[model samples]
Target: MSWQQTTLGEIADIVSGSTPKSSVPRYWDGAVAWATPTDLSRLDGKHLYKTDRTITEAGLNECSARLLPPGSVLFSSRAPIGLVAINTTPMATNQGFKSFVPRPELNADYLYWWLRANRRQLEDLGNGATFKEVSKAIVSRVKFPLPPLTEQRRIAAILDKADAILRKREQALTLADDFLRSVFLEMFGDPGENPMNWDREPLSLQAEVKIGFPFKSAEYVEEGIRLCRGANTMPDRLEWSDTRYWPVSDAARFAEYALVSGDIILALDRPWISSGLKVAEVVQADLPALLVQRVARIRSSVPAEKPFVFQCLRHPSFWSYCNPTETTIPHISPVELKNYPMIKPPRELVAAFGMIAAKQSVLRQKVEQDAKDARQLFQSLSQRAFAGDL
Candidate 1:
């Protein structure tokens, strides 16, 4: 097998898109899928099956937005470029995207994967200092190693299968998280439920609550102390990609508020959706770092009951208590949080909840590991395929 490097323009026709007038009702909402960069992030496969917004045929004619065919590749061109997804349906995109309709000799899937693997190169092509964008000419001139069409399909199928397995594992993780939440609710009534039969206690009585240090942007360095931001904290776990770092010199100021091995961090902002209230146990040896400002750290006063409280914090009932009233940003203040009450159950019941949480944590870890392995396998196959070694 022989491989050749050629510019995208040699094999595909690059087309730009436009949006229709907002005032025209007919063009505002129609059946054609309309895609944006945000939608690209949620895509599960090489081809996007649906989009958040749909445009009308009238809109297509009214604006420069063209109706791209099923196999055309879509790439973001503005703000940040290089994110790519294939269209599985006839769709139109905003000016932020540039569509590529491949020639018959090229495989759409192969092109999509190639673009993803070389995303950094595309980002480098961005010319603006403030907002990076890939010009149509620059995008068309980008080159890559291309194999025969037959090989491309085979390689794509292998990667697709691996990716499918990873997606299934991810779905399983979501279900497990839901089940854990259900268990927490069953053991303890909803946060709003005032169980007259059970003893009520302030959160301060059961745990030590402390706010994190105020970290200025200048204090952030490439790698030093692990820092937890609002984005890092989620409902049940911390998002690794959301983790940031701070210079070690700033660590002393946050030493008292540093997360212990079992402490839980909660975001205090409101409309619960945007708030990053979540329970993240400090598992990493070096992660005993401070939580950024706007986050509250909760550590169980009783060491044996830490996991139990962590589970309770993840319950939907708990979120109900913290969720703010009809406001644009849903949030609960530190004062409100300190006074929030928990229904005191028997010691055995608390232990049972802890056991369930521990089991769920194991399952979550396994699921994440499986997903990581699947991704590695897919990447290996992709590399071989592009190299004509498949």
Candidate 2:
């Protein structure tokens, strides 16, 4: 069964956003809540409580951005699109958003989930050479199935509960991550302090760091051996959802760059993100993948050192050493990584930590699988809800 077909503009007030002149000092840090795509991207849930940047009332008046009322659905239109959030407070956004103020019959949460569910469709509507952006006209013209007002609220409530489950699972994974970091600290004091008098050595002695090949985008294939690039790497995790592929026939040419379990991969380009260092250790599941440019693969000289080497890189202090603020581009160089001072714990202690790490890895894998399942469940719910099968 299908609900009434309707365009977004028919049921919502389409609002275009703009930025105030950044050069003016008086325009920033004011009472008005100014938002950008980054603000929406930073949020963990549907409701955005605050913004990273704010504008003065005078500044808001000087630009096209208007303060949207609470419950307005914000959809990021560019700089990587399809970020959706509902504002809990009045917010004004920059041009990257084509936000929607719902009519009395349209539920805000419903719109939020609908946009999220149909992200790929929305992304396909984007157009631009340098970067893709979905224009106000494009977003407003997009059609969706509109259920009755009561049905919308009910659907939103159900999705809300489902999303809460996903969040809880995510929280559990985070706690596991924290536990590993704490374990590292307990076994070996902070490398910055080196309180245990562990003999320090340059990372090159314990690990071989090799940068990746500059794989041309034109040669990318639909399916074959996967290319492991910076985008696939996160702290202690490799996300293969948006993976790129290389031709399997040519895989033998890059045999040296093939990833094996226990290898640590690091992103050399803008390596320091808000989420800590872009580093991950390859597991058995990540095998049969070849390396791509701007990503470094570190293999342990002594297999027992693998766990410690990875923890050293995952540490927050490792990023501090990068001093990203001083550099024009936030990057970690091959030389810097090779020369990184590593605190070498005693072999006995390293073996103990390795044992603990392996056990934790198994537990973390199960939790991660649960998290993946929860996300898929939410996606399925959204699809059925929108398809009127709920």
Candidate 3:
């Protein structure tokens, strides 16, 4: 099939967003869905139907921002850029986006996926002294080969089905997350209230909080032992993507940094974000991994203590303890992390809760495996669809 090579500006009107005055009370909180890069970053779906904050009519009138119609593709332009989403309803955005209002010839879903596929290239085009930003002009100049209008819609439809599958898998994973949280809550009576009046203690008292080895980039090897960094810590589990390795010879020197099964790990930096938890317990499969810097390993005093502490960190109530400072990179230092309070129940109670947790975890693992299979299918379909092979 033949494709048309064209710049984005040729197919859509690129509009920049602007923020209304924050100090004006009249301009704040109204019916208008006003978005920001932050909002787009947290979006789990392809379409943005509502925003965390709304604006008044006066806010719309007072600023240069336009009321984007449905089907407009919103793309973040600054402060960690290249997040893309489509507006399902009429909306407005802060100055952090350069939105594309698709023309009659273009399908918004097609444009959304195209932008996502080329996000790395788009992000690389950004330039600024303070923080990277891809200007409206830069965005408009992005050229790509497009199929005919009918083909665009057809391709989008195929991709949408694949995307829907991915979304369902994501929903399943989220449900699994919710199930774990629910189990914790039911067994442990809110950690915030400590209703059981369990003994309050510093995390350091019950665990060996050891920071990872500060290995330089030069220390990385092609293959030897897996190194778990801050990025590897996911919500209640470890993620193996972007796994780095260190020389086996150095293993003796960094033996203390080694992780064993059931060790609870936490990302000392940016521990909490709009995304879920940055803490997890090391599973058996993730054994023999070395803890890299900015990640902390919490070796429980006893095997039973592992599940208790891991669940505590996973609790929503623990978010208040992980402070996001005013600095450019938010982090909780090892000193501060050690001081995090935990309510400890009796050994017998914790052991019983751990049994229930093991059963629930088995269910979660099955759902996760299904999600993994679905994700792989979606990724394969997405590649074929984009390559005109769908």
Cα error, candidate 2, residue 50 (Å): 2.0
The predicted structure with the larger TM-score, 1 or 3, is 3
lDDT by residue (248-343, candidate 1, tens digit) is 876786678677777888876532443335546665543656787778888887765787677667666677677665566665678777777866
Stretches of candidate 1 off by over 4 Å are 79-83, 127-131, 193-200, 215-224, 231-235, 239-255, 267-279, 315-332, 383-390
Native-vs-model 2 lDDT? 0.89
Q: What is the Cα-based TM-score of model 3?
A: 0.88
For model 2, what is the alpha-carbon lDDT of residue 174? 93
For model 3, residues 124-169, the per-residue Cα lDDT tens digits are 9999999999998888888866888888888788778877877887
Q: Rank the candidates by lDDT, best first.
A: 2, 3, 1
TM-scores for the candidates? 0.82, 0.90, 0.88
Please identify which of the two predictions, 2 or 3, would achieve the higher TM-score against the true structure: 2
Q: Least accurate stretch of 10 residues (summed lDDT) in model 2?
A: 320-329
Q: What lDDT does the true structure give each of the candidates?
A: 0.77, 0.89, 0.85
Worst 10 residues of 1 by lDDT: 270-279
Alpha-carbon runs more than 4 Å astray in model 3: 23-26, 56-58, 239-244, 284-287, 301-304, 321-341
Better structure of 1 and 2 per TM-score: 2
